[model samples]
Target: MFDLSQFIFFVIGCLATFALVCLLFPHLFTRQKKFYPKRVITAFESRMFTRLKDAFPHHHILAQVAFSALITHDQIKMRNQFNRKVTDFVVLDREYNVVAIIELDDPSHIGKEQEDAERDAMLIAAGYTVIRYTQIPSIRQLQRDIR
Candidate 1:
């Protein structure tokens, strides 16, 4: 029985089901907004970043840079267990080669000493200098260290 009425009812039913699903889960059907505002660096880190920029005008002072950005994905597993760790500041030369990794030591970092040591070891093994500071170092000291 090739009923045109049955075909019409089937199409209507499918459309109704789809409309119901979309109404139930509007987010799934709607276009999502992706971009959001975020702070690149904390207040304390911002001050340090400013000092770093002033001190090393020629060098690149990257704040809140990710470890994954610096190292290849394959190298990450070879280096250490921590995944996607970020350094407080990564100083790079004019050629974009890493010059040094600077970590700001505060009271919050006390419990994570072992993790910090492992990260430092990995960075040093990769031939980059690692400097930890509780307080901001003088511009002269930074110049001496980088040199």
Candidate 2:
């Protein structure tokens, strides 16, 4: 029933309506994403955190701490290597001084000996005690190793 001009007008009207709807509710035309909080530490790390807390009742145990938080280098290149790398657990004395940089070597760390050593070496060079644990240590072992 529509001639060429009428058909063109109808199409234009439909497009305008669609454009208006999109402008009013742009989210309807786009993908909706609902973000939720994710766990900062892994399940194994969570277990370690709990154990560390139990082991050192008077000390503070900080998990997933970046090296940059504790150490800084004058060279940008040197900083870049470890600035963003995270240490598993940073044991702190009652006065909040860093006691040691602790790394839990679960199955995931099997092939990363050289890399781990390098990371440890960096901390060691900074005069920090770096301890890597193959498994969760008993309270006595933790106390002994930390001392």
Candidate 3:
């Protein structure tokens, strides 16, 4: 028959070794810094965001937010695939449900028509109203469009 005492000692030795390694190399188990400087919003985006905030005082407006934050994906593959797409701005109701997404179209978006369209399609399919603006619209227009 096997020796039970020997098995217990071996298990203890393994546990002690793991603890010693963790203590000696604590950094290996710690998370590394992954954030760096990045603009939250461009000047135009800032101006439009301010207008949106004023127009919809009752709602919350988030700028330069990832699409994943606004919607849930049942499939892990789809979620990971689309997690990198960022929205220009998102308008949320009092309960924090996304009401709409606003994109400020600039010169840079000219060549990205297909990509933008795809993103818009995805957002729309997810039941969010998507609005694109070439220039900042008046508060009244925003109110009318959003409503």
Candidate 4:
């Protein structure tokens, strides 16, 4: 016999099961977020960024520039190589032409020399300048390197 109390308990049990499934497998019921806000630069990069602005007062300084923005290749493979690569900082002339690509190499770069050189060679081959610095250079040094 189907009693009212038994029917109410069955409904509550079904609701509890549904809630448990939703909680355990949220993706089944909710869309997952794919992206989030992030810092554009690190503390070291931020310090160098301030120096870039001061050293090149008349020029434009852009941080975290995608390599794709400054270089292009007809080959899909070549494009893919740089498609996700980002330069630390890009210095531009008053006319907005890229004067130099600066990569501030911290201790993290100790074992990445070969990789960095390969990336630099790719940029150099494309007729762009790539400058690497282990530490913040003197303003005069920055001027000398780019000029």
Indicate the TM-score of model 2.
0.74
Write one digit per residue (lDDT tens) for candidate 2, span 63-108: 9899998888999999999978999999999999999889988898
**Candidate 1 residue-wise lDDT, 19-137, digit = tens:** 99999988887798678899987787888888888889999998877776666536745635545678899998899988899998878888899989988887776678899988888
* Candidate 3 lDDT tens digits, 5-80: 9999999999999999999998888888667898778888899989999999999998888888777688898887
Worst 10 residues of 4 by lDDT: 27-36
Error of 1 at 2 (Å): 41
lDDT of 2: 0.91
Give per-model TM-scores: 0.68, 0.74, 0.71, 0.79
Residue 20, candidate 3: alpha-carbon lDDT: 99
Q: After superposition, how far is residue 38 of candidate 1 from its true place, in Å?
A: 3.2
Q: Count the backbone clashes (under 3 Å) in each candidate.
A: 0, 0, 0, 0
Q: In angstroms, what RMSD does candidate 2 have relative to the true structure?
A: 5.5
When 3 and 4 are scored with TM-score, the better candidate is 4
Query: How many clashes in candidate 3?
Result: 0
- Candidate ranking under lDDT, highest first, comes to 4, 2, 3, 1
After TM-score superposition, the amount by which residue 23's alpha carbon in candidate 2 deviates from its true location, in angstroms, is 18
Instruction: State each model's CA lDDT, in order.
Output: 0.83, 0.91, 0.90, 0.93
